[model samples]
Target: MNDHDYYRAFLHAVWHDRSADPLVASLLAQPAFAVYRNTIFKGCVDALAANYPAVQRLVGAQWFQGAALAYARRNMPQDASLIAYGDGFAAFLSGLEEASELPYLAGVAALDRCWTEAHLAADDAALDAAALHAALAAGQDVRLVPHAAARWRWEPAHPAYSIWSANREAVETPDELAWRAEGALLTRPVGEVRWQGIGPGACRFLDACGDGAGVAASAALALEAEPGLDVAAMLGALLQAGAFTSFH
Candidate 1:
């Protein structure tokens, strides 16, 4: 094989298999090879920890580092940009036997990943709430468009939103609310990623908006999903949160 092919194979083995390829086995004896391997692996681990802070916080540093390294060994970054790494980490964690006890841990990691993505997403000008209201009053048929950076849908299988929020404050979650299913909405309305827990109705409404539905149609969908939901209040809350980038 050519030098480039050999090197690529070697790196794949070191990063994904956590071992030296037979072709590069001789180099493994060199201290520098070990150092290089450790450095690359550690970089992946650190990136994961940074991106999934809530997961790390829940599992504790040492445990998280171990888990991170394990995940790194199994999943190499698809892109060279470490910032975009760990897209499948939550799924990886969900499959781990070690994380079986904490089923919600994976969901928390997913939220943290969503937060990272929202933070790094491209900027967009949010539609002004007053202007949207004016358009509605004028009887214009406008559909609210979510910002490019918005993560308006994050409905985890487990009740992880509470755990993620609590991790931000380093506080213990109340037992009663710890495992209650929750949803989250993330948006970068003003250059800062902001997130909040959303109810089933609001989540449904946001989903409809994301699908390019108008305010009235989205509210109807929300009401269909949750009969007693206050559609007007939910729309107001979404508007106040700067969830829309423009009205179409």
Candidate 2:
């Protein structure tokens, strides 16, 4: 191996407590190596804590740190940028035995991940309602697409959206949150990310848009999914929220 490769191998062995390299086999047990290993693991834990602050806040720092440590040990970052780390952390939480008590924790963590994605998404001008109307009036077959910074999902089994929204920046939650499924829509309309809870129909409408449907078709699909849904209002809300961009 080259010098850089050997150096990385040495660090990996130290972190994993493996004698993978003959030259570094003896050094792995040394005190300095242990300190480096611990520091690296601590950094991983810290990144996870920052990435999933809602999870940490929900469970408290001590418990979150413990869980983070376990997650770090098994799932190291695949990229140099720690910001993109913890992609599967919500699934990891869902499988943990201790996490079973908090049925909505994994879903909350998933929304937290969505927020990060929307925040880091590329900048673009959102599609204005005027432009859409003009295109349709001109008889153009214009497909609508979600904005680059848009992220949304329909959690059909839990009130994940409500729980996540309430607990994202604050420790407080609703006094009596309805025990039902919810959906969420997140987008970077301006420079910062913004979010709002949506209904299943809205989620389906966004899905249809993502699947390359025209705005009218997407709204039709939404209404098909929910017969009583106010698709016009939903479309208006999404337009006002800067949820769509012209299809590329």
Candidate 3:
């Protein structure tokens, strides 16, 4: 076999089949090799811990570490950079026996993943209010363009947003109202990640905009989601949150 192919197989054995590989078994017999393996395992655990702090806090450090190790063994990182690791962690948690008791845990992990995504998204300029206003005035139908970093998705199954907010701020007492289905919006404005729970109307409006719908059409969608939705207020709030890059 070629050098690259040989090393690739060796790495796969080290990562996934150490016990079965004679070379790995020989290495396992050495204390130094064991230390190296332990260090690699710990690195994976630490990266998971950092990526999912809310999960770590909820499950306690020991339980979280055990779960992290198991997850790492099952789903090794495909990316060279650890920063983008743990994309499937939420799904992994959802399939776990322990997570069955905590139904919202998986959703919370998913929400946390959104934060990472928002933070890592490409930076882009936002449309000035005056420019947007001028475009709206000139055009019969204006379509709002969303920022590259902006994302809005409603989680209806569990209070994922509330749980995420509580853990993010380390709240001593969480709001009871937060224990319901809510819309989550994540964005990066001025190079800092910001996220909040938005109203259903705003969620629909944002979704419509993302679908490349015009303002009038997006407003109709928002109204369908919430008949009493304040069209002006919803638009203003989204604008203030830096959700839109331009309107044309």
Candidate 4:
């Protein structure tokens, strides 16, 4: 094999701990390579931990680190660049049968992942109240374009928002089990990620808006999802949160 091919083989052997295999050891000594391999593995573990703090809190740091280690071993990041290292972690958590008992765990991981993505996403100008008011006054069809990084959806049985928020604070952790499934939105309006729980109606409205539905149609969808929901109030709340970038 060429020198380039040999180097690639050496790296794989070291990273995968195949150095003990006859084919690998023939090229490099095992003891020297093992040290470098351990460092690389630990670095990946640390990166995952830093990326998923809320998950770490939910599962406890020790258990989270352990899981991160295992996850890294199984799914060594394809990219050498660390900026997007944990991109596939939500899927990893979802497929882990051991974590299935905490169904919300995957959701929590997803929310955390979304937060990271939102933070790094391209910046956008926020819509102002005056502009929105004028659109409303003119009776122009208003449609909100949420930030590209925003994630809005409803969960089936987990208070994913509550767990994420409560864990971020230094206060006592709240009882996640008591929380019923709720709709939530995560956004980054000014370089900071924020999470908030909204009603089913609001979620539906946001989903509609996200899909290019007009304001009126979005409101109607919200009301359809929850007959008792106050469409006017929810719209006001979303506007105040700077959830929309523009009205079209």
Candidate 5:
């Protein structure tokens, strides 16, 4: 095999194999192989832990580490890069019978996935209120585009965010009774990712934008989806969240 092909194979074996393959053993001694193996495993564990902090909190550190190791062994990421690892983790959690008792766990995983997506998505200019007002004054039918990095989803649990926030230090089970499926928006504004729970109207509006609807059409859809929804308030919140890019 060519050098490139040989290196690729070595990487595959190092990442996926619990036992060192002959190809890897020939290149590095057994001690070197063991060290490299530990490094690769620890790297995967660290990445998973960083991405799924809330999950780690839900499951204690020891259990979380065990689960993460199992997941990494079973689903070694195809790409050497860890930019978007664990994309299928939510589904994986859903399929695991052990995690079946925590129904909200999968939802939390989904939220984390969205946060990852928002973090890596392409950057865009935020729509300013002054610009929007100017466009309105010009009688132009301008349509705001939601930021490419922005994402919104509903979780069937109240205080899910609170639970996630608390998980950083203490382990507290959220009150499922008081929790309703809460909708959240994730966006990067000024280079920092922010999560905000939005009202039904704002949620519908953002969804409409994602579906390629114009501003007026999205507003109408929001109104249809939620009666007594303040369109202005929704627009202002979107603006504040830096959720929109330029208008067409």
Candidate 6:
């Protein structure tokens, strides 16, 4: 094979199946290649641990690393940047037989993924409360959108948000949890990632807004989820959370 083709096969073997590539088949028995392969595995595990700190903390280092290694076997980083290594980790975890008992683990992994996405998003000016109010006062249907760094998730199956929000900073689990469906809102409004446990009303409202619905329509959706929801107060809270970008 040509040098380029040989190199590609070698790398493919390192990342995937050694026996599957002609070049890799030749190097598998070499001591140097073996060491290099182990190093790559360790690097993938390390990258996964960094990318999913919340998951690592919840599952502990040994268990987390074991799972990370397994995940890396099937899903290696497509990009050179290790920071973006674990994109499908949550979904991967969800399918793992080992993680079946821990129903919330995959959700927590998803929350961690959201935090990473928010942290890495391009900076954008969030719509101030005054600006939003002014556009509404003018009786105009302006296009409003979630901020570039805004990410939210709502899951009715498990209290994933509560557990993740609590364990995000440190490994301090709450003394007691209500154990119900929960939602989380993440934003990097001021160059620092922030998160909070949100409610069904806010979740539905954000969902509607993200679908390009207007203010009234979004409010109706929120009210449907929560009959006595204080729509104005929810807006103010979301405004404070930097959930919106500049209105057009």
- Best candidate, lDDT-wise? 6
Which is better, 2 or 5, measured by TM-score? 2
Q: Report the lDDT tens digits of candidate 6 across residue range 1-248.
A: 78898877877788775666655697886888878988998999999888898898998899998999998888767888788788999999999998899899999999999999999999998787787898888987666699999999998899998788777888577778778999999999899999988899999999988999988889989999989999989988999999998766
Q: Give the alpha carbon lDDT tens digit for every residue of 215-235 in model 5.
A: 788989899877998998888
Model 6 CA deviation exceeding 4 Å by range: 2-4
- Which sections of candidate 2 miss by over 4 Å? 4-8, 138-141
**Candidate 6 global TM-score:** 0.94
Task: Using TM-score as the measure, name the better of candidate 1 and candidate 4.
Answer: 1
Pitting candidate 2 against candidate 6, the one with the higher lDDT is 6
Q: Over the stretch 1-248, how does candidate 3's per-residue lDDT look in tens digits? A: 67786566566655775655565567666778667766777888998988888888788899999989999887767877788689899999999997798888988788778888888899889869887777777766888899999988787777788887778667643655546777889889889989977988899998889899999999999999989989988888888899988877
- For residue 5, model 6's alpha carbon misses the true position, in angstroms, by 3.5
Clashes of 3: 0
* lDDT, candidate 5, at 221: 88
Q: Look at candidate 2 and give me any clashing residue pairs.
A: none
- Runs in model 4 deviating more than 4 A are 1-15, 18-29, 175-177
Candidate 5 has its poorest 10 consecutive residues by lDDT at 160-169
Write model 4 residue lDDT over 80-184, tens digit each, in one string.
876667888888998888798888888888877877787777787787778888888899878888867677768778887777666656455664457688777
Q: Go through the candidates in order and give each one's C-alpha lDDT.
A: 0.82, 0.85, 0.82, 0.78, 0.78, 0.88
Shift of residue 51 alpha carbon in model 4, Å: 1.3
In terms of lDDT, model 1 sits at: 0.82
TM-scores, all candidates, are 0.88, 0.93, 0.89, 0.84, 0.82, 0.94
What TM-score should be assigned to candidate 1?
A: 0.88
